[model samples]
Target: MAVSLFYRTGSNAKEWSGTFEELERKQAKLRRASQRILERHQTQDGLSEDDVQHDLKQQQKLDKSAEKITEYLATHQEKTGIKGKPVKSNITDPDSAKMITSKGTVQGYNGIAINDDKHQIILQAQTWGSVGEQQTLVPVITQLKQQLDKLTKQKQPNEHTIKFTADSGFNSEANLEFMAQSGFDSYIDDNQFRKRNPLFKESETYETEQEKRRLKRSKGRPRLFTSDDFHYDEATQTCRCPAGNQMWRSGVNVNSYSQKYTRFCGYLKDCKVCPLQHQFMRKPSIKTGRQVQFKNDESRQKLSYGDKMKVKIDSPIGRRQYGKRLGAIEPVFGNITVNKGINKFTLRGQEKVNTQWKMYCLVHNIEKLRNSLH
Candidate 1:
């Protein structure tokens, strides 16, 4: 399966005005007043009888004025037309402007499109309010699966697991876990180290010579357990570590990417105190806590798979293939943003925005169908 993602540019309307220093002064005044109340409360012999009534009234008046000033600032901060003035119009809705970016903005709904392998046609499309592509992976995957299932019922007799591809923005521990749990074959790029050109590095030249010398010596003892040694068996609900130790169920299940998983820790506490704590614990903070904490072999096993996926995505060939993600997904949004003239949102709230996005996806699909037929 081919994958793409969509992002929208944030509105650049001038919504707030006033010097940074001026804003800081207002905040400081609030803090000083708060400290004064605390100090008076802590004075010797408890608060003076007369001071108590006077202080309470003073505090109440100050709080009331502060609340009014905050409301005024929010309601009348800056006008959209002026360089530093709040908009005087009654339109408080944020989604009314045309979305624009360095790459050009979509007029209506910002979205991405994906094509399934069976037919080089749009299989999945979605639009979102935010500009970040990383958050869109799981949702697109879910939509792709649903679309595939629908297509299979209508045409093919056999069940097939869909494959997805995207760039590094979609990389994350959570997204990788989603891919493993869903059992989708994906070739997403490893965005973290993609910018490096190893040929240009001096270290590569030195390492080449050093490796030849090292190969002449005998290999050292094998690691007790690499992360690869642990396997998460979802069916049996257990993690078998490389050393033949079973990491059984521990309390508390963490839900991530719409999947539920119970944590597991090794019963062999002897392994915990080993010098390889860094490898096992991963995070130094976790090591400081009780020696035994919630650990899931499935999560661990999934992590190993994720690492391999990262390696594949980081390869030169992988980067070239994954770069197609931008081309594949972006034009779908361009059609809506540029052709349709849908810049700002007319709706409010997440549910409405999501509905708006779905409509845009439907429109994109219609355009694709038209293009295919002609």
Candidate 2:
């Protein structure tokens, strides 16, 4: 049996943008304004009592709004153990976090579901408040084990070997290791798994040179020669430009993204005298020279999980097994969210949201059971 999972997002109840300290400062300013309004009622002979009372009432209303903000901060601060910039928790549904969907950025809960391959019956469902779905794999598998253990005590269900498949989002080294240690035949895709397949060899089409020139014209900037326009020789540690000029190694740089590169530049005299300088190279003479940066391979090979998964997932048998992942789990989410109209979660807290998620999955499984009986 193929066991698979995917994420279904929930809607947000409210939104908050700033930090807790900023909220507290606004509350303090409101209190001071309220005090100043009452003091003006006692003094300032030109002012009438009615005007002073009206100002006080307006300030009081603002103070009440600040009070509500303070209460929300207190509740969320206790709930989320970690706090950092662009504070994550929503004001109304404190348990939900900000997630990016196809529509836009949404403050919501991530609903995870595991389903059986035979009839697409949901076996387990969980809701999480994390932005990324990578860490949710372990918890989903643990719940699946417990649910299957309970079923053994109830009755004799179909006995079949369990197989797991998921998308690239769940393709970390630790996750792959845990799946192996748990003794399951798992087929998880890495980020570039499909690129490794021989079937996609001719799928990549490059932009025409005329199209590239048109883009340069629209941008209102002179076309600069990029690194891809140069040819590198592995046998001889050197690089040559499109004009057949050998570029000398200028400098080495360690970038912020943990990648190393060697910068190459042509001779100043050669760049200044070349006819193609304005066409391919930087036109300005003060600009050092035609520069190109080549990335080193050391930092790239340090992580092997991507390469390892690519080899496994590119196999013929692996493709056949993983093809069941989307059909197995995605229909369960579509049935609950689209067909059954349980798209937006009505609960506020984490525990309540999780219960609602499970209830929807249960309803889906019951419908599957009813169809099988007929």
Candidate 3:
């Protein structure tokens, strides 16, 4: 599993802590490794000039790495895993080429805060070198699950399943499917799905008329059905079209907001033969209008539930719940960057970086526990 390392601000402001003694130890190790590699490449007659030059270049690279480690430690005075005194620096100054990572770039370090759904306390906190929240969801949730498992062993028996609540950032079809299969309950948004409501007038009168004329020009094609084509006789629970045609009913599905809707679709032949065929055959000319047709079963289910979820989330109670997210997760980063003063990573390679990240997370959790006791 990928580990999360939390921080405030961006990558340049992220904090990691080590002593001057530890830096010296790492420098010595690098020197020894370089010496060994050079010795193995030497000839029996001593050393060739070419071999010597290669060794020099290798040594220079190692030396540069060591220098960066030293400079990082000196500029920040905090002990490992502890918050430090803040120092002012030229925030506008750009990082030199030497400071760039292997990816040949520096980007924002997004702070992620995963909280316990029950208590609203932050469970896991970490920062990512990448921007956007989609990639961070699984790793953060996994870490939070681990913490919850440990906490559950010491708490009540009834609390077993883990529930997560996140904004639209963590809401993707794949993520939702993963959470459902993992035995986790999530209130993730269906960001891609747009609800179709006839009451909302989005197109202007002139634009609507222009669209109607365009549809009239394209005849003998697949006709599209507007909301006007279907009439919902709620008293009889049946749908009829303006051309005196009955619609085929596919049972009702209940939505998240307690609104249930019955789905109805018309036959292709009935639509093609009708006077409305011209309007239905032509694709909608309105660039931003919602389609009135039910594309699929999943889409039909989403029509009612998706809108309710959006409405509920925008309510006062939902706003209060969402407000807790920033507070719960952001401090883990502030402690690491502003408090601990760890800016750039000392290690290279993905595995090494991951190990370093896990260590940072451990330190953050310990700090949280320590502060809670006080």
Judging by TM-score against the true structure, name the best candidate.
Answer: 2
Best by lDDT: 2
* CA lDDT of every candidate: 0.52, 0.66, 0.48
Native-vs-model 3 lDDT? 0.48
Model 3 residue 72 CA deviation (Å) reads 29
On the 0 to 100 scale, the lDDT of residue 363 in model 1 is 75
Whole-structure CA lDDT of model 2: 0.66
How big is the positional error of residue 74 in model 2, measured in Å on the Cα after superposition?
4.8
Write one digit per residue (lDDT tens) for candidate 3, span 145-228: 677667778553222123346667666545654454343433454453222121236524214675467547744132344554
Q: How do the predictions measure up, each by TM-score?
A: 0.48, 0.61, 0.39
Worst lDDT window (10 residues) for model 2?
A: 298-307
After superposition on all C-alphas, the RMSD of every candidate to the true structure, in Å, is 17.1, 17.5, 17.5
Q: List the residue pairs that clash in candidate 2.
A: none
Error of 1 at 211 (Å): 7.2
lDDT of 3 at 310: 40
What lDDT is reached at residue 210 by model 1? 57
Candidate 1 residues lying further than 4 Å off, grouped into runs, are 2-5, 9-113, 117-121, 127-135, 154-161, 196-306, 315-320, 339-346
